[model samples]
Target: MAEQMGSCKYLFMSLLMLFQVVQCRVLTVSEIVDVKLPHQPKSFRIDLVHRDSLISPLSPGNISSTARWKRVLERSNERLRKFQLDSRSYSDKVSDIKDAQAPVSSGTGEFLMKLAIGTPAVSYSVILDTGSDLTWTQCKPCEDCYSQPTPIFDPSKSSSYSTVPCSSSLCAALPQPGCSKSSCQYYYTYGDSSSTSGILSYETFTLTAQKLPQIAFGCGENNQGTGFSQGGGLIGFGRGPLSFISQIGPSVGNKFSYCLVSTSDPPSKTSPLIIGSAAGLNAKTFGFTPLIKNSVHETFYYLSLEGISVGNKALDIPAGTFELDSGGSGGIIIDSGTTITYLKQSGYDAVKQGLDSAVSLPQADGSSVGFDLCYTSAAAAFPSITFHFKGADYVLAKENYLYHDSTGVVCLAMMPSSDLSIFGNFQQQNFQILYDLDSSTLSFAPAVCDSL
Candidate 1:
């Protein structure tokens, strides 16, 4: 039900409460080095793969931008509706919702990155999900698996592969575990009824030639699903213990940043995901904002959305419309996978009403038929829209965050949500966003992602 862009099927993360066990390595280990990249000595770049990219076999031909936006809004609402039905509760229930909503590839999610795992280092196109933690892939001896275009990872062939013993600390952290005789078994089920079960093992995760030793991930042996067949696996960047970031945060200074390009951009070249010591961006350019930690699930990067200003005027929206609660149900989250922004009803009304009043022209696109895009003959004459984050005043330029359709329509790439609000990827195009775990801060600056 949670979709970056969204797919036909709803994905659910199986993290049932565990009854535990016996063999694996401890958490801390030897220092790992960054891979040698041609540029940016300490930094490496990973290309951002768009959804249904023309270069990708799963993608159809380029559809109209108008059609794509329509689909995005529709998908956003559909997921939110499911979320409403699920009805976020206390911590445990909220975690279930997050798992239920996690992205599993297909046509609806955001960008995909080519990541490598194991000794021979097999490259896998994994969907990047900031909301998720466990990085997993369909592995060899796969009794059950999806029909992936790429080869399944064979750990037996990789020299660095090792099974995480049922007794390791990571096993304790596993949200839901199925007990087995020798090793830790993981059985995950998506909301759509798709499921994957496998062993928790240690593998060398390669990012840009860097052989990160002792990285723990799920070796999915029996996976039955209809979603995310295009890629080999999923990459979790959440704050949980098993996430790639949490595992590597110590060596990389607890900082990572990505400048997202438009999914409509050319597939050959797009944005880059930067990590390690290289993530110390210029503070003056990319101003900092204190990130709110979720009491329920610490994995999400929450931010307090104070208010919004249209034409340099702060709208008189209801107070506390964008509050970040410890429960994690309501709040604004900056997500990498979601394509469009979603504002809760109160915030939406204030912003929409302001924009409607400021713009002097009629909607050029189809709104009567249910669309969020708007148009104006004097689009330039329209005032600017600003988002007030805690301790920051982030600004959005027209072309940077808005889409100017072929029909000369200036559309707002955001809409209203009945449940939680999200600041999506479309609003993040060409901007560098840094998540510093150690400092508990999130920062952003305008960037030409294609050039970077």
Candidate 2:
């Protein structure tokens, strides 16, 4: 009878363990699908929809998966070329303010925001760019302009629109400020040779049902570029004084955060772009890394990437491989507009070698898919990649680093760069990334962006 009781007890214990394992698995799946937000109120919240989303104004409707992938690669390559040129330009500092040039790009960003301008407010869709510094839109009286979906903004219709005089401090802040009979004139040339010429003006900007008056922006009269034709204009979120964030940073405590939903998820699921204090941040859950400063090029956010690891083994890379030199070269930048992560040639080589050794799957040709490292099997288990920032260790999920093309090709979502390394939006998906200007640090935590 004692032996029978002992056997029954063992059976009961096994059942309890099995029940707990099932319960944990269900909880984990639910957490991934639907993340709960903190109860605290957000200061300013905006919906950031992916450009490919059906609800977005810039959505490319019902294209083949292959065509869509090709387009994505093309845009990423163009943006990467722009960054490479910009790095050289930053190193070659010009003493004279007249010769100062700012590098700009059009229609390469993956996210779009719907914002209103003027006193009565005219709604327009614009590209969101962290790499750019000036907020601009196509204006009326077009000598040369691209065909945008929305009507051009006519400053004459807005009662609150006023051009900035050349003598104003704001006008002088422009890289290459011009004067057309006392009115401040601005000309911006993109890396792709696209250009925009217009008058600097102050107008009321509306975001998320809130009115922000006297925001300085460009009213482009002569804008010639295929990149600008896709959307109404571009909104700059760089660190420069004229950027939208810089102009409003003081009021918003110099803090901003964004959570990008995974591209694999439904495009209809929108991400959250928080402009003030972010919710659900703590020391235990979130990791912090210091933001390295680049006096020459202040617009880009630089970070010190110590090393990288594939699975559990660290890559054999030389020290200071990702360090920023005094001349503003060889640093990693976190960019919201870029789609894929780019690494310096040396670093890229090491990472690729590491991934090749760890992923035990048959190799596949990726040239047609726009990737270098690819595998044939989609169901094969893959190792996670971890980025070792100064004080933070960000471990990426398999979905973050591996791109499963619709044609049954699984490829690594990274590339080699000849210039500066970039931490692009693809690697940043599903993480709440907070840029704290006041603390000179960047904090991030894993999250389900759609729920946020």
Candidate 3:
């Protein structure tokens, strides 16, 4: 049986799917809707923990740089700890304030949307995530508890949702070797505490206008925890088919991408995550860099670093160091688990210095948040900070670097002086990032950000 062959004893079959080779072609922004993405098998999780010790291209070598990087990360750690304390200490105040500013739409929790899986119409709410992958949700039983913000997907109600036979070739290719059971039991754990477990099924899942004819996915029977609080389930962006975009592949579009605009920004102006092909990037203007082979899962996209720069001034550091992860949050999440952006010592220092020179904010006691600038007051225009990817310079927008917190406090710099540089969502949103699994190249171009 396919399931038995894909189990622990069938390591070869798993390897074939995980490392299958294919010739890759670059897709232009306009081609996003034109190309069909290949249906490649995705993986479960990274085996190793992402530690600060890992080299970042920007961080490179230089004892002072390393120390400074650590110092900044330490400060960030302290600030985050304090932020958590502040959150708990001023919980009531913050909560009340949030309630007053919260839009009527915000309180309703999940947003309901119809999803079609391989020609079958199934109703489900996809919890939009800027920070995760592996989209999944409740299905079948529809019976018990777990109050969801939107309606759950009923397989019987869907003409297309069907279970993958235990012996199917595709079913046996699940990354988690032994997990290819007849009943379809699979589990996934994220860098965050969020996780999901469910049975595999094939169906036609649809987005607003995007449609995947026959996509494979996990139809969770028991969806629980704070992770599922927002809606029916998650619509992950990570390199896994568990995500709607990943499952749809070349059939719907040749590639997948999204642009995350700020929530504070106007509704009409939204970030788009384009799958198959991106919309604004000029393929001719874009440069390419070798993507790191899955140091973890075959599905993840990674890049080896040489170094980074601010303008013409390049940070003196080692080459062939650092890795790029799209899954990071904030501006650049240097670490695997930490949610905030972790900048390299030089990058953080330069950015912070620029901010400090431009604006100022005061602590409760009037002592400035101690940065070159603080977000407590209205912001003044700051200098542009360009992240040097390989030899290309990718510029960041003003909004991409600054954010007003829940208290209307603007954070001039997203990362604390001490965190490792992680090109997080803040920086990522400005460019059209392409992860070519076949060629193992990470390519992007500046849309709002300076050209790369």
TM, every model: 0.82, 0.86, 0.59
Give me the overall lDDT of model 1: 0.72
- Model 1: per-residue Cα lDDT over 93-190, one tens digit each: 44654565544322235677888888788887887878667789999998978787689999999999988888888877776776588688886654
Which stretches in model 1 have alpha-carbon errors above 4 Å? Answer: 1-42, 70-87, 90-108, 263-265, 282-284, 364-370, 376-380
Give the higher-TM-score candidate: 1 or 3.
1
The sequence of per-residue lDDT tens digits that candidate 3 reaches over residues 10-47 is 68766666565422345577687545445432211101
Predicted model with the maximum lDDT: 2
The stretch of ten residues in a row with the least summed lDDT in candidate 3 is 43-52
Q: Say which candidate scores most in TM-score.
A: 2
What lDDT score goes with residue 167 in model 1?
Answer: 87
lDDT of 3 at 132: 38
**Cα lDDT of model 2 by residue, 336-452, tens digit:** 999899998999999999998988777899888689999988888788999999999999988888888778988899999986999989999989899888888989998888777
